[model samples]
Target: MPSEGRTFIEEARRSQIIECAVDVLATEGYARASMARIAQRAGISTGVISYHFGGKQQLLEAVVSEVAKTATDLMMPRILAQTTATGMLRAYFESNLDFMRLHRKPLLALVEVVTYNRGEDDRAPGPYAEQHETSINDVIKLLDRGKSTGEFRDFDSRSMAIAIRGAVDAVPARLLHDPALDLDALAGEFVTLFTLATRRQP
Candidate 1:
């Protein structure tokens, strides 16, 4: 049981360090969030970070994965709760905005990391990196389903899906500039806009 307890403790410390990293990155931006800052936030020595993650790059990847997992876990159930394709698509926007509203800090940090943080080669986060498109793909699936069911018109589901994801993603920067930005109103607008764009006219 000693080994099991040690493993559990290590996992706990990793989680703590990742959470602190998210907070630091979110509040201070990528350039300012160093290993020492994250360690200080977690109340651990810098060596603990090295022992657990080896360096900042690994920790940044962990932070990205954690936030992506969070968005999936939070939004998937809501998206699936609706039966109709339009309803599913609407749920995607609403649930995503709700998540952004609730988990602004970690998500903002996530955006900064993917957009600004570069590997040793200095490349932007690769296609294999950053926020996965599972959620957006799910929206595309809903559009395809609606089209199959004669509920939506044919007009490039893939393009529309990308547009929809882009719309909500632009919110974080807006919120940064104006913390009081009405995300709910914007979500509602997107829901209505996309619904009309995808739906067949009666």
Candidate 2:
């Protein structure tokens, strides 16, 4: 029970640090979000961060992972609940936007980390990049499902998926610039735009 209690406290501290890191990353950009800054935000020492994550790169990876997991947990259910390809597509956009709207800080942090953070070898893509590739692949599968079912017109699934991903991703930067932008309306526009693009013409 003592070991279990220690593990719980450690997890709690890690979560707190991750949350602070998200805030720092969102506001300061990844390059400026040092361990000291995050530690200050968390009211803990930098050594604590190092003890938990070893370094900034690992902590940034954890930030991406935690945010992505939260988004997936929020979104996958809505996407999975849909019975039709069109419904799934609409849910995909709506749920993604919903998550972004509700969790702007985490999304912003994710954007900054994925956009600017790099690994030891500058040429190699990082974990966040790999996660994005996985998301694109998932969208391709969804598009293929729609095409197979005749719910969507004939088009290159990869191309359409990439377009959709780009549209969704461009939102965070937009929000960064215009915090008052109506994401609900924007989400509606996206659903309509992609629906028109993919749906079979009457």
lDDT of each: 0.83, 0.91
- lDDT, candidate 1, residue 123? 60
Compared to the true structure, candidate 2 yields what TM-score?
A: 0.90
- Candidate 2 backbone collisions, by pair: none
Choose the strongest candidate by lDDT.
2
Residue lDDT tens for model 1, 60-106: 88888888888889988988888888888888888888888899998
User: Which residue ranges in model 2 land beyond 4 Å of their true spot?
Assistant: 1-6
- lDDT at residue 153 of model 2 (Cα atoms): 96
Model 1 error, position 129 (Å): 3.3
Structural similarity to truth (TM-score) of each candidate: 0.89, 0.90
Which one is best on TM-score? 2
lDDT of 1 at 70: 85
User: Residues 90-182, candidate 2, lDDT per residue (tens digit)?
Assistant: 999999999998898899899888788777678877869878988999999999999999899999999999999999999888888899999
How much lDDT does candidate 1 score? 0.83
